[model samples]
Target: MNRKIIFTENAPGAIGYYSQAIASNGLVYTAGQIPLDPQTGEIVSSDFSEQVKQTLNNIESVLVASGTDLSKSIKLTVFITNLSNYPELNAVFKKQFDGIDPPARSVVEVSALPKDVSIEIDCIAAL
Candidate 1:
């Protein structure tokens, strides 16, 4: 199977030992993206909705780098620091995937995440 590492300046560079995404077998597997802005290297928002927007944008960057778009997403895995924010996060998710069918998704509350972000999103996309 052909495979390639994917990276983009539009997303936060990976902080650890992982590429932003990988493309193989006509699919793109994106790393979990936090709310940090690539240009500013800052978590742009504290509000749950805003944070979710930024995280989704980051995920989009990686997906684009791998030659796909949200429309091609097959699955998404969301990690949140608090389940209490699920409603607000859902609102953001709707806005992010606006007018498009969302992929199969899983949401989980995690003990913690890098940089203490409130949310993170990883995706799988068919190219």
Candidate 2:
């Protein structure tokens, strides 16, 4: 199984000992992405909606670096600090997916997340 690491300047750099994403066989698996801005490496905003957007954008960047895009996503696992924000997440997904069939997704409410951010997301997509 051939494997390749994926990276992109359009996304925030990994804060730990991990690549942004990895492509193996015909699939790309991305690391969990927080709401950090790619250029500044800071949380994009304190708002839940903004954090969800930034996290998805980060996942998009990783997928693109792996020769795929968000439309090719097979699945996504979202971690959020508050389950009450699920509606906002769905609203963002509605816009992001638009006319296309959205990927399979799971939204989990955790007690906390890295950087004290409100949300994080990771995806699997076809290469």
lDDT of each: 0.91, 0.93
Cα RMSDs, all models: 0.8, 0.6
Give me the runs in candidate 2 sitting further than 4 Å from their true place: none
Clashing pairs in 2: none
- Best by lDDT, which number? 2
Residue 102 lDDT, candidate 2, scale 0-100: 99
Range of the 10 consecutive residues with the lowest summed lDDT in candidate 2: 59-68
RMSD in angstroms, candidate 2?
0.6
- lDDT per residue as tens, model 1, 78-110: 999999999998888787778899899999999
The digit string of per-residue lDDT tens for model 2 on 57-120 reads 9999889888889999999999998998999999999999999999999999999998999998
Q: Considering summed lDDT, which 10 consecutive residues are worst modelled in model 1?
A: 89-98
> Candidate 2: what lDDT?
0.93
- In model 2, how many backbone clashes occur? 0
- Sequence-dependent TM-score of model 1: 0.96
